[model samples]
Target: MEVLINLTLNGLATGMLIFLLAAGLTLIFGLMDVLNFAHGGLFAWGAYSGTWIYTSTGSFFAGIAGAILTGLILGLATEKWIIKPVYGNHIQQILITLGLMLVLSEMLKVVWGPNQISASPPSYLAGSWELGNIIIIKYRVFIIAVGLMVFALVQYVLKSTKIGLVVRAGVMDKEMVQSLGINIQKIFMMVFMVGAAMAALGGVLLAPYSGVIYAEMGLEFAILAFIVVVIGGMGSFPGSILAAVLVGLSGSFMAYYVPSLSLAVNMLLMSAVLIFRPQGLFGLKG
Candidate 1:
């Protein structure tokens, strides 16, 4: 029972972090069809920039704020300067974003030096609570709480707000929405910025969980997130969360029970999902 609880908590924490990232990717890559390989660059930037501010200001919350702000600003610049020009060209989008990914990563080394920096949770979230044979980490619970809040907030926005309705309508019938005099370009930009901010938040949160931050970490996790996106179904928000949780729990259990197969499990799962249901578990056939 203790082992079960521990693994559940661990998986939940990891899932939430991935959800933060995958949620944004769903908006940009899934809905807007941006294919933004540089989204992870925003994440890496958040870790480095947010951590720097946290260390400097002695406040973790402030670091989160800094990261979100940085992501929003960077997202705007990238959408306008980099992505806008290559909007309709998938090949160009892939090439440009991939190149930008490398640039953002290298720029991290330039600014912070080529070193892996360690991160620690704030004092309030530094320890664990013990219950009989089980121990629950405060930070992990906090992460789960944050993930739930984000999921709920996003759902609320998507369901209740005018902007959310328009975004959803845009995703389904972009031409029709545009015919109604809606500036889909601006909506696309907003989605990109929000997605970037979510990715940044994930990065900042992950630093403490990972205990170290590196530039290439973005690509590594981005791969996992891509897998999640594929498994969850393109443009399906709820599907992303469910798929992320499944991936997280599977990884946790596999790592403990079959360490050698831990890495292969993700690939195997993706392959199986591809083979069995190409549209993914929740994907729609548009």
Candidate 2:
């Protein structure tokens, strides 16, 4: 029973983190059809920047705010200079963004040096809670709460607002949206910024959870985010959340019961999904 609870908690926490990362990726891809290999760079930047701020100010909240701000600024710059020129060109987007990814990773070395940095949850979130023989980590709970809030906020905005309507419509038919006198370029830029911010949020939250962070961590998790995006459906925000949770739970159970299959499990799942539903579980068919 205790083991079950622990695994559940672990899976949910991990899922939330992945959801935070993949949510942005899927949205961007769905809307813009541009594959951004450099998205992970934003994540690494968040972790490093957030950690530095937390260390300097002795406040976790400030650290998160700083990280998000960094992501927003970088996102704007990336959209304008790097991504803009390559719009509507998948080949160029892939090549340039892949190069950008390497640059971002290498830049991290220049800025933070070659050492992995240690991170810890703030004092208030450092402990665990016990309830009838089950122990729950406070930081995990906090992460889960933040993830849900973010998801809800995104959902609400997408479902209840005019901007969201335009974004959703644009995903279906970019030409139609533009024909309707909408400046879709502005919407694209906004979505990119939000996605970048979410990726950064995932990075900052992951720092304390993992207990240490390094430059290449972004690439590592970016693979997982890609998987989640594929499995969740290209443009389905809710699908990303559900897929992330599934991936998280599968990993948790497999790691404990079949250690050798832990790494292969997610791949196997993705393959099955691809074979069975190429459009993804929640993706709309054209």
Candidate 3:
């Protein structure tokens, strides 16, 4: 029972991390119709920058704020200089973003040097809680709480706010939204920025969880995020969280029970989902 509880908490923490990255990808693809292969680069940058800030200031919250700000700035630049020109062209988007991804990764090496940096949770969050037969890691609980809060806040904005309505309407029929003089371009930029910020947030949080930050880490996790996005549904916000949790739990259990198949399990899950439901578990059919 203790083992199960531990694994459950571990899986939940991992799922939250994947959700942060996948959430941004889904939103960008769903609303903007742009495939951003470079999204993971942003994640890596956040990890590196946030870790640096945390180490320098000895304040984890400040590091998170810095990472988010970095994401916002980078998102604006990418949209304006790199992504904007290739809108509506999947092949171009793929090629350009892939190139950008490489550039971002290389830039990380240049800035942080080609080495893994260690990260630790703040002093207040560095320990574990004991409860009779069960032990809960403080950092893991903190991560879960943050993830839930982010999900709730975003859901509220998407479901109940004027901007959310506009964003949703734009997703359904952007042409109509544009006809309504809504300046869909500006909306697109805002969505991209928010998505990037989410990805950065994920990266920063992951740094302390994994205890190391490396440039290639972005690409490594980006693959998982993509898998989660596919399993959850292309544009379904709720679906992303569900899929992330499923993936996280599967990985946690598999790693314990069948260590050799731990990595293959994700691919198997993705394949099964593709065969059974090409549109994804919650994706709308055209």
lDDT of every predicted structure (CA atoms): 0.89, 0.91, 0.92
Candidate 1 Cα outliers beyond 4 Å, as residue runs:
none
lDDT tens digits, residues 192-262, model 1? 99999989999999999889999999898788788888899878899889998988888898898898998
> In lDDT terms, how accurate is model 2?
0.91
- The lowest-lDDT stretch of 10 consecutive residues in candidate 1 is 277-286
Q: What is the lDDT of residue 144 in candidate 1?
A: 92
Error of 2 at 99 (Å): 0.9
Taking all chains together, the TM-score of candidate 1 against the true structure is: 0.98
Tens-place lDDT per residue, model 3, 1-286, is: 9999999999999999999999889888888888789999999998999989999999999999999999999999999999999888889999999999999999999988998999999999999999997999999999999999989999999999999999888767889999998988999999999999999999999999999999999899899999999999888889999999999889899999998997799999999999999889987531
Q: Which ten residues in a row have the lowest lDDT in candidate 3?
A: 277-286
TM-score of each: 0.98, 0.98, 0.98
The per-candidate count of clashes, in order, stands at: 0, 0, 0
